[model samples]
Target: MRSVPRSAEFRNGGISFWFRELGCPERRAALLDTVDYDVCIVGGGYTGLWTAYYLQRADPGLRIALLESEFCGFGASGRNGGWLSAEFAGSRERYAQLHSKGAAIALQRALMNSVDEVIDTAGDEGIDADIVKGGMRLVATNPAQRSRLHAEVGYRQEWGFWPEDLHLLEHTDASRLHVDGTIAAAHSPHAARVQPAKLAVGLANVVEGLGVHLFEGSAVTEIRPGDGNARPAAVTEHGVVRADHVIRATEGYPVHPRGQGQEWQPARSSMIVTEPLTDDMWRHIGWEGREVLGDAAHAFVYAQRTADGRIAIGGSDAPFRTGPARDDNGATEPQTIAELWRGLARLFPIAAEVPIVHAWSGAVGVARDRCPSVDLDRDTGLGWAGGYAGSGVTAANLAGRTLRDLVLGHGTELTRLPWVGHQARAWRREPWRRIGPQLVNGLYRTADRRESRRVTRTSRFAGLAARMAGREPHEPGPGGNAPGSPDRPGAIGEASGAAGPE
Candidate 1:
């Protein structure tokens, strides 16, 4: 559905996030006031649209409908950091412990391959996603961070051999990239970057092109089972449509009222974009207009350069909130901007002086274990998928296809992957979910300080250095599919045999 474009005079307000450029909106989509469809989706963001797109393509005659609350591109999908990185964000060791090795590998393989899937989609849709393909680089901030990287390398090897894509960049070269005195940095060609908003809009365009029914300004308030061959119907504020199957693709909005344990916590992560850099600044920083970069700093700042030439740096700094929150997520703390500026100065002094041109923040439904969840409701034949922490660009692409396959009653290697239904332990109702993020946020701050004080590695192979750090100490717990029983929702994965021991 078309929305009146937000005026250019509008300011960034309390937030400071800026995303890739996407053009004009169209007239609002007409509501499906009547008739029955095979399936109904609630949410017009990337995950919802992508699921509808593939599902319709896979089964053409199957009538499908997607309803968006506002105009498309109004959520995190259009307001993200625009990093299309392929390297999984969750620790590799955790992956080994969470899923069966084979299933983990398959899941990782699908996620890794989905990088190309985005590129292909952009190409097929004739959308310029501003994809830069050189790779993504992970810079280490302290000595302990080195161990984590080495451990990840070993664990990655343990699971399956990846290409020799990981490059161990040391000192002088590291400093050249603004990461001076860093212990070590890992570079992988497998990762890529792109313009986010244009991609989301392009996805919406493709969904419409496929002749699928996508309604904007339609927020589904309820889903009730229908009679006979017609499935349950999705009712919205404006109108309603009867359908056979309903897919609750709402990530931020957890509409499962009675299912307290089936909740997904919402988190508010923010970003800031600098004014276009001076030409001299770019030559020295030498990302060479390629690759997104993040350091092993416990704070985990991820930065990428935009096609229009601004630098977008994003980090988690606000209290986590549940449901679709754009403004109420909290404001940008002055201290955070100060800390981020210091970080930028540490790497690129010249770029630090550039005035910040834009800033904004959005919420993501992040699970405690830092992985997305794909759960199903057998009684209603309803499927759910969300909780992607922050790596949703590529993960959502793969998840959408996987979600589609699962909804269509097909089995996939992705279905058996460790992450699908394996959510962390539940928070007892309210106040806890709100308080828990601050707790985790505190841990992250402490961890960052801890990492900074650790020693730096001197050589690529200091003979014994890599060996000690690379040692595979112990196997992580419950890494693969638990075959015996379907777990009860809200139970910890470990207790349910869906994850490693607590």
Candidate 2:
């Protein structure tokens, strides 16, 4: 039997191991007085940072301001699993329903390209976030999972993904990774490993260097739309930022202006990073390629090999908090840490003895439908981009570019993407909001448990849970399962936004 390390054995909550490795960035001064700019972006996470980056690049003369409640990269931006994979954030069928199947395919293709876009931008900006485009591995350890894996690969092919984009690994090729109990695997070239905090910090610097006003510790209390000749404004504790366009880029930690908190539910994901593994441990693991790893299960895990020789993995074992409350200090529960550690051991037993150096938690915004959206209202000069679930790393970049197009009123292809202007219904209120995630996640956990016991087909419990969440059981969506399932194929085993382990 695997040994469970005592909670006291590991350090928890210094934000994350990534932040501790690089050290927290010096906090910028907060917005102390009213300011006016062409664009004011609320939130300093990737969505806001990317939006600022793209808008500044598009028009260097346009004055922009970015407001953050804490230091930049303090949220999920700094705490994500660091898989910059081209995972679609929402259901393709849903997107197709809004536009056309062709548009949905275009969105997938665009996201695939976004993986490279981020890498290229990082290179151009000289931001080294330990990126390795070695690709992603989705492993299936059981018969039920293996069946879904095959269906996922088939779905991708049917959706017109190139062989180089996605393909099933031969048994010999699958053996190369040496992950325990891997019956089958799928490979996608569009994923990359990154140090998420580094990227967030570096991008913040890049935008600041471009003359965008970045006000750290500036909490936006409310975002008020413009009226008559007035411009939209972001009201903060210290001051107000009035701008022609006010972009809400708060992602998982949204502070809705009108108490419409149910628009996006804040979900939490926890992670654990082991101390640097020894060379012998690496040999036993055989993850020389350093591909981002995931498993095909209802409740899944994502992992990456750090440049400093540690394994950082995360998942959504405990996915939500009641109401809109979230843990800002990155504290993770003991059971979550233990569960994540056990998952790591299950995948790579050789590292089971490695001490866990750090464990932390972060939030991701999940829309009711589990899809992401980028919307802009020209008349009110109000705009927003987020709800990436757990695929925000790359999706944020696309959102930033799309936001730029919308703000500039450019009839670009990005403006035509189906997710642009898409708005998911608000989540159910009250006890349901609190109980819904826990209940669904519990069902998923149960389904995963049953699947582990040699179940031959996808568990009905999973489908039932999906249905309860208002997702089609058999349609391809962000978190859907089954062949041509409602969930997006490439992200089947991916961590949800808060639980993003990539």
Candidate 3:
């Protein structure tokens, strides 16, 4: 049997470095008494909190209650890589197929606006999240990666992104941005670096201050829809929360309501953070721009320069659990931690000496179509949004706004976004659900290793793997994963749970 790696010497549960520095929020009282409200939100992450935030803003008199199994930011929202990016979690082609190409473009624009919306709201609401809009810097170290970056740029321009919005840089130019061994790079101003935990906690505080009742440590056990003249209710071990409308906002965590679990495949992503780097170390690694960084590998890696000078990096290196159960405490496998360290060293040779200070992991939801969705059943008064497929930061904010519009019965632009009302097919049950994703993960790992060994412009091995991984080759452009628009099909975490949440 393989021994777990020693790199897991630090904190391994889902408590992120950001949370370690920002400090988690104190647990609030559980729901011991039955209560009634205008709306009841189950989940205290960004989706739930943001929904409460906007709902209160839209109608101050509306009573909103948020329920959490743990303290706010205790799940993926607090442990995610701090990238507020416009990268949609699903294929653009899928969105176009559901709606229209114009609709897809509108969704992209809305996501971009959501990034700014988050930054602006944090400032206006006194939620200091160390927000830095340095944009995203995607680097390619191999020939295939270089070609893929170029293709992505062309697609973006064709999809209405200005040439300036997606600019490609040569190795010489890109090397100035701290990423070494880059053959090509691309920069998009539609992304930002943030302290995720700070943002989640700040939002929780903001919502609570807005008269939204937030009940932590209250694990919701069931959701019962009301019939005529009755209100929907969420049952907990403590009591039942009855409201006119019940919204399911628990992404990554288990959804208590029946039928909801069929739609989401929970996958865990692992992460590690290095001890504070010295000025000399930073000088050697000239990433002063602080743009959130990612590589062009099939097993993609994402990183951010923390406000405290630490390099926190993460990837989907762990196996998905057998059931809906999650690694709630943030602990990750020792091998996952080790691989992340190796990736960091490879990306920045100067960081080989940087000791790791913290390690953690978190789960993210994957819809059957690998896209985020928002919907409300007017008949049952039940609304839900999640399955972000690792891009949940800004997506959650957009989902919150969408839920608000849906609940208020407004046919606004937010409600018409391509993701709204899109019904993804449910994942296969049992061993198939568990085994299928594992096979894809194994194929991806094999392909990444084989491609590096061959050093070829394109890897047939990775292509075959992608096909087996359930992604169609015909996916479109704009986004790298667009169906049939293959400049670089491997640019995304195509494997079900191959990377960190947004």
Candidate 4:
């Protein structure tokens, strides 16, 4: 039974619901026989499905198969906020270290391209995911964040690239746009929104069309790596999948560590959808922006309106325990979801009247450096992708192509991304990984405390002071997972405006 009310009237009159059609049907556990292929994907989410689609497209003759523990899109792919974005993990300095600039650019470009690829793929494959293209908005809550937003645009210009759909907003204009506490706003067309479940089903459909075998309900219990000429294989409840390469595509709740402790750490994220609002309510808010928006909150909160005219809000910075499981839908604890609900309601007054129609939680992998990993264990033929941290939608598609190119010995631009070389294996066991999140959250909380004393937070000194008070400043640390330190989250002013892609 649900701890909270599962069904209730939302702020607006229209009701809201979640996408229930997830996973691929062909991969169901009712397998009649075993099969072998050139590539065996151990997941059915975006990474696996996209990889299979691209791999088959590149070479129709290559034998590829995808195996999912549940159905396709059973994880984050189906339940996410439907954010189709190319936002970098954190910073460019991090990017430069991941791979060559060309590689990084190519990597993101491929993901950006997948936005269209996904839309077209959905239509062509007869999967209706309610894919919509409105653009994405990032709202700044303060001047400091406003400055950060400007710096980002400048940095992108220096990089000699900016998405055609980038825009910056001032406070006066931002305040009138609809939402409150908005000081600055940024816009970009490179991002998009989609119906989560349909995307997975559509992509899976496309892969199946290409003769790729898909197995659903085939939860992989173990993975056997390749040795010498032997290929890698995934052992599932239904049967065994053998292939030249085994790709682990589960993003949020990724599989157990393979070779290292930094392989993956599961972090729970929660979200709620409201009953569709009336047109008059929308007009009262005058939110014609029709874009996804995230604000500068101590705990990151992003909300977007769906194609069906309902609001989907998500919060990720809630305190959580690692490796904990929720409903199959992957929601966080009840209190956490309630807190996020309150946050959402605070941002939009109409949310009070709009009852929360549906709520769910899911998990994602956090690497040591807080980046995703695309590694191919040549010794075992067990290639995998994980640690997307928070932003994995667009990255997942590119990861799939990269994995395929690496497996096929094809040196394409897509494969040259820094993602392949950036591995965060064995992070949870790492001291920093284990203790870093807690300390960072605590520092953020402290900053929040200090900022609360004043009207606004200003200066790098303040951010520094917060960090200093929270953690002992040490030399730059390596990227990997370890337990995080317990500290309150100080408000690290956010960049309210969206800038050019990193």
Candidate 5:
């Protein structure tokens, strides 16, 4: 095991470092009585908040109420790795299977555009989340990783990504960033680094200012689809919120409702942030552009340079917690923290001595097919958008707009995207759910270790894991699992639970 700095503080399960820096916002009053509205959106994270923002903008007169179990952004929204990239959460080929390859390509392009949309919205709304459009860099530190990096570039090109969207970097260009042992790298301009909590809190205030009712500390026990005469409703402890349209926007943290329990499996990802670095340390690091960073490893690591000069890095070193249990408080294991620290040290030796100030973890929603979806039942007046793996930061925005279009009965370009109404199969029940992720994670970890030991090719363990997961080795999903499996690339986690109402 790698050595960890003993002086570092451990603040596990305290929400997250982002929330701590921003100071948790004062909670909005919980719902005290039943209410009626044109729309009731459960979960006040990015998806629900953005949905309310767009809906109110489209029609100011529409009554909208957003319910949250905790304060807005309390879940993955505030706990993510702060990457607003154009990466989608599902398989491109899988999305193409639902529509045409052209349609899937369009969806990818739309996500690329959504990265800008989020930046522009933050500016328009005066939400200063330290937004910086420095782009993203995926570095290859080993020969095996280099092979996968080039393969990913080719994969993107085959799927219609223009050169400007993503391209290879020369060794000199890759060295400019100064990540240790980087032999090759890929760059994409369609990404930004953000102070995630600031954006979530600011957006919450913006929607409330727009006359959207936001009720924090309001946990919805269940969501019921409307029948012939009844309207869709979000049943909460205080009261039932009935609306013409009810949207379930909970990602990862589902309040399970009936048969939908296994629809999304919540995966827990852990993170650690260092104390602000010194000026001398900064010079040695050479990440002046402050672009978000990732690696091509199967058990990948993701990182970002905070505006305050701290380095926040994360990975899926922790095993998935089985059953419906979740680490809602952002608790991280000591072993997980040590593993993440080693990753940081390996990438930037300068960070080895820097004391870690905080560590936390959060869950991300993953569909069995490893794709995200946005859908509404016009007949039932019910809708939902989640299963982002770990790419919810940008995908949530697109989902919000798509949900708005679906709610308003609009047939715009956003609605025609392949993920708009796509539905992935449910996760397997119980023992399988518990066994599958553990097995896959173990395989990927072994593959990474083998690659580190100078294996010049992608390990067979990774291929085997991909096949076990019912995917090909060339098909990358959300979080980094293997070549063809569905998993989050950077901000990934592991856990199991029933899909419940938002």
Candidate 6:
């Protein structure tokens, strides 16, 4: 069914195949003169774009300006695995412990709603990103994984989730979905597949259509919040953007103004997309519905069947750089891409020979407590949202709506969500931040290897690894499920580099 030739080789380097459909958005003119607006947003990824969209809808007269270092969606937004699942970054218990259970549940419901909101809005806006609402399936290949998955399902039911929201499936039932080696699996109907770059480009265009000033290639060098009496301003090398409010929506990228380095840790994720499969290959896989698929591993993998019949798989085993640095260009490490190919082959052996057509990597911001936050300080007229921990495609939309509510001082249900006004602890500097991700990655892979050999009980080493990695013990690594969902718990650049597409 693929129109593209199977002989097509890898498209190496930064640009993903998703971004090529639009033939690369011409970089808009940079801001060269001082400009004044009612609102100034830094980072033109989904967070900024969505925030602009909602804000303009709420009040069209609000003068808003958005600045991006590169083109919009050039960061994690353009390069993610395109999963719009209701996966909150932190544990539901964590959210409840920090705030109230009501608040936690409210946030969970909001996330579930955000997925539909995105699809509905995209339709109304005429932004076709090859969207498919097949939902998500998480397979457990080992007994240990099965145990954890069942526990997750039980926990979700206990939390008052309807039986239909999340439930387990037998191996036979799961195999029908093309996820091989499925001892057990969890299914959730609240997910969808998307073409990440197309959605990003579409949003950028839609927001521009709404009269929002989008400045590409304009990197913000400084963010100067105003005193109680004055307005805040974002300083670019060529211009200054003064506004009543200043927003920092940079996810996965380095912290700007040369400070707040400890505020967020940069984690990288890489992915590889295989050449489009033939009809015979499709019959072999048996995933005609094309539900977004993920597996249960200490170091997990996530995948989706591209509209073009290709398979794009992603994971976060790449080494972490020192000083919390990020790779702006979506380039992949050879080893990372190879590992991803191996993961894809393991899941679908019939396509083991499928050529990988593209590979890329991106970075995402990780908060200290592994939870995202949206906060606005009316005193300083500063608002920001990020730290999605990797499951941010849908979370970003929620964050944008939350940011809009906070900025406008409406304080509806969006603002009442547990993540609103949250200030996670800062990550440790250098040795701890740099060495932590590597240590965690090594431990997870080791745990996965050991668990694969065992027939009963989860590995104690895996639990330790999860704890060290700042994830809940027994959860299926980082890409498990929504924190409070029946499946288990769970990112940001709209699509943090940890999860793929980026």
User: How high is the lDDT of residue 83 in model 6?
Assistant: 82
Positional deviation of 94 in candidate 6, in angstroms? 2.0
Instruction: Give the clash count for model 2.
Output: 14
lDDT string for model 2 (228-255, tens) is 6888899988899999999999888887
Cα RMSD of predicted structure 4: 5.8
Error of 1 at 12 (Å): 2.6
lDDT winner, 1 or 4: 4
Please give the lDDT score at residue 432 for candidate 1: 47
Which candidate leads in lDDT? 2
Candidates 5 and 6 compared by TM-score, better number? 5
For residues 209-284, write the lDDT of model 6, one tens digit per residue. Answer: 9999999999888888788776888988999999989999987775454345456666777777888889998987
What is candidate 4's lDDT per residue for 77-183, written digit by digit as tens? 76667776655543334565566566655655665686676667667778777766766676655554455455545444443236464557666656544765566
TM-score of each: 0.80, 0.94, 0.93, 0.82, 0.94, 0.92
Off by over 4 Å in 2: 1-3, 6-9, 259-261, 319-322, 474-491, 496-499
Off by over 4 Å in 4: 1-17, 20-27, 31-34, 98-106, 155-165, 170-177, 256-262, 324-329, 430-439, 442-453, 458-502
Candidate 1: misplaced stretches above 4 Å? 1-10, 13-20, 23-27, 30-34, 89-99, 160-165, 170-176, 180-183, 225-230, 257-262, 318-333, 375-378, 420-427, 450-502
TM-score of 2: 0.94
Q: Write the per-residue lDDT of candidate 1 for residues 1-502, one digit (tens) a residue.
A: 2221122443353322333244446636757576677877777777888888899889888888888876666666766667675545333455667766676677667766887887887787798778877676766655666655555454455544374745566565555465555666766666666666677777888888887888887877776654455456677766887766677776654555233364455555666667778778777776774777766544456677777677767666533233334454224555545555555655556776677655566656555454567765545656667766566677777778877877777888766766666656553455645554455444445445544654343222221221322223232111110000111100001110000000
Whole-model Cα lDDT of every candidate shown, in order: 0.58, 0.80, 0.75, 0.59, 0.79, 0.74
